[model samples]
Target: MTQPIPPQKIIVHQLGRDYKSATRIVDDILQDPKPGQIRLRNHFAGVNGLFDAMAMQGAIGYIPLTPPFDLGVEAVGLIDAVGEGVKMSVGDAVATTGLGGAYRHYQIIEAAKAYKIPTATPDYLAIVPTGISALVALEQVAMLQAGETVVITAAAGGLGHIWVQLAVNMGCRVIGIAGSDAKCEFVTSLGAERCINYKTNSVADVLGEHYKDAIDVAVDTVGGSIFDALIDNIAPLGRLVVSGYASEIVEGAKPVLAPRIYERLYWKGASVRGFMNALLSEHHRDAATRLFDMMHAGDLHISLDPTVFKGLQALPDAAHHMMSGQNIGKTVLDLRDGV
Candidate 1:
């Protein structure tokens, strides 16, 4: 009888202040799943720029980050093995998102946690957690409404592209904020009414000049001046959702010596809300189901970034590409070697 080959996975062998630098592609051999568990052979893993960086730095306050931690969250793969009492069969494809599960050749996790899908495609990896985040942040958190003016920062990125399309589909007038003209164009092609290039244009100036007092909702991941500008121009009763501060992931949140946030909110009855996906468990399934349907029905699209980073060895470069603010779409890691 032939013996099974061991799997390889990535780990945070050390804590570095930066994510692209802290990672190590070490050899990993996961044990067989226990009863009610399934062993997955991951094919594609989503590159979460901000969270990856934060997790490496041990900056996510709620989650304790120790060395030798598994370093990915969202992945799509096929079941390589299944334990007793597991409902999913071997060779069934699934997509999963959770701490310490992805970024590996194979993962043994509870069968219930691995959501079954048609196949292990990059599209599933693009949508599972990232698309779920965008959907929940816009619909559940921001209460996105039709005919409203919606603003999305990092608008050409994974979540932002989905946000733009979802808002547009809901009949909202969507405005995207990105780092470059090409990215702006990309967002506009996705049905955004306009996209502000933050690199060449002033976010505050553009919003102030053309969109002042009209932004009904804003989804921002890039904090700092962009956040201040969104605050400065929010309409009365507008809602701004902060999903993640990509700008401040490595650099800690800077204490701004400006007028109190309430000063801006009190007069307008506006609100700034923070969002963490783990904190909002109630909406995950609904959001995930709806988004998957949307994509399948052609109402939503997944724009995978052109750059291909394959295997555990390429994860660090993938992280750098995403956090560099240069990637035009979802940066995906193909797990099949040389794929």
Candidate 2:
């Protein structure tokens, strides 16, 4: 008979407001899978700066959980054990993405909630939650059409980069906005017709000069001033999808004067719609399948941040790095090598 594998677990514990103040490494043990559950030995966990920061501060308006919760959402791993009624075999690669389940070395999840990873690559780390948001927001929420002009803010970031590729593949003219010249170049290389360095160039001015009345769909991830600028330049009957407000999430959100928005949007017939993946949970599976297909066919590209935060102890630093605006792609934590 084969020797049974030993159980091991390590978690990043959040104690209070701020990732630094709240997060700590804790030793844990894996529990036996109940029926319909599968135990995962996690390999990689994707990090979301806004989500992590907001979660640490207890400011994620949509999620009601308080402090003392696990600190991650998405992870890719292999099945270490399977319980009764589970159809998957041991050693199957899978991904689990949701609230409070991903930051540890081992996780017990419902087999139904976990999606089998076609291949165990780092890119799927982004596809699980971030790429799903990008794909769904552009295809479903924005209703993007061919030959239209699409503007994506934070275009070199995790979600933004995928949006750029998808929009480009959809036959749309893409305009990407990034924080620096290098990031602008990165976005441009992703097939954006134009890349605006928000730090140096004025978004409204650039659009007004070249793309005036041309934007058909605008995806705004960084809100505040940029959101206002996109609205100012949007074409008539355009759709502006708001997936996140990183500016507000990190620095604090400021209220836009009603008159400022009214003047820009009233006659244009443009609409600003808020989007949260949680609200559109029903469509996640289909979107993930499509994204995976696109990725497999080389129609999509996934960029992982060069900096790898290994082990549960580095999660707090990874979160901070993401929020500091230095990471060019998806921030990930490697949990496979032991905590």
Candidate 3:
């Protein structure tokens, strides 16, 4: 006779910042009903900006959680038990991402979307690609060509840094636009040929002289003013990739691109494309594996700096630190560290 599966302890965590009041509330959800999904003991989970935004808008309804909807989007865990049809073994290490509900000690995951973390690869590195979705979008969706001049705004960010390295490795001359000197240096360290601290440099003066004609591709990770600044500088036949806006969540803070910008783009024979990485499928991931291979070979370095947070209870503070851009690398809440 087959043995019955064992029950496991699971804790889900989340935080919501009120849209108007900006008050933050975090809670640990108990998912002990032992639902019909693969039970996993989470090892490391990383925070994301999208979760923070959703929290601010009070849009946590879509996410599946026990009581408090878990806010994390990606995590690495070990499979402890499986529901009826799951194929994973009891001790297999896997990483689940995208469908929300991470931040936990143990949780259930649908079978198909879970990825097995290779024995040689660390779980933290496996989680990197999932969180840097924008980088994947900029590289794959855009079909960025080599030897072109590419511009990336907010170049110091998690997604932006990967985009810079990916573009550079593709043989593109990258120009990074960052808010501070430290951010500029960060981009430069990632191999961006030119780093412009937008706060200090005149966009027009810098681009007109350096690029000569215009930027071949503009990967705008920062929306609002930075997006506005790139409109006139984009080259003829250039592709403008808008992937995110981290400017301000205070509502009406990030103004949409004006109609005139589209008109200008049309006149210049350029195209503006909006991308969401969630739309990428397994085939797209196969293509990105080439980039990842490069990363592993050191031809394109894309590892996140390890920032360890204490425990599940401290997720609120870590989330705030992430939102504030205080954490340099991926802030991983080590589930086993305290357990």
> Over the stretch 214-287, how does candidate 2's per-residue lDDT look in tens digits?
78899998888888778878999898899888888666877655775666777888888888888888889999
Model 3: pairs clashing at backbone N, Cα or C within 3 Å: none
Using Cα atoms with residue i matched to residue i, what is each candidate's TM-score against the true structure?
0.95, 0.93, 0.79
Model 1 gets an lDDT of 0.87
TM-score winner between 1 and 3, please give it: 1
Q: How do the residues 1-339 of candidate 1 rate in per-residue lDDT, one tens digit apiece? A: 545445787788788866556777766766888999999988889988678877888777788888878889988999989999998999999999988778888888899877788988888877888888888888778988899999999999998999999899999999999999999999999999999999999999999999998899999999999999999999999999988788875788888887788988999999999888788878888888888899889999999999989768787789889888879889999887632
> RMSDs, each prediction?
2.4, 3.1, 5.7
Instruction: Tell me the spans in candidate 2 whose CA falls farther than 4 Å from its real position.
Output: 1-15, 257-260
Local distance difference test scores for all models: 0.87, 0.83, 0.64
Provide the global lDDT of candidate 3 against the true structure.
Answer: 0.64
Q: CA lDDT of 2 in candidate 3?
A: 42
- Could you tell me the lDDT of residue 275 within candidate 1? 83
Per-residue C-alpha lDDT of model 3 across residues 161-245, encoded as one tens digit per residue:
7778778877899999877788788888888888998888887678878774478888886677676667777888888888766
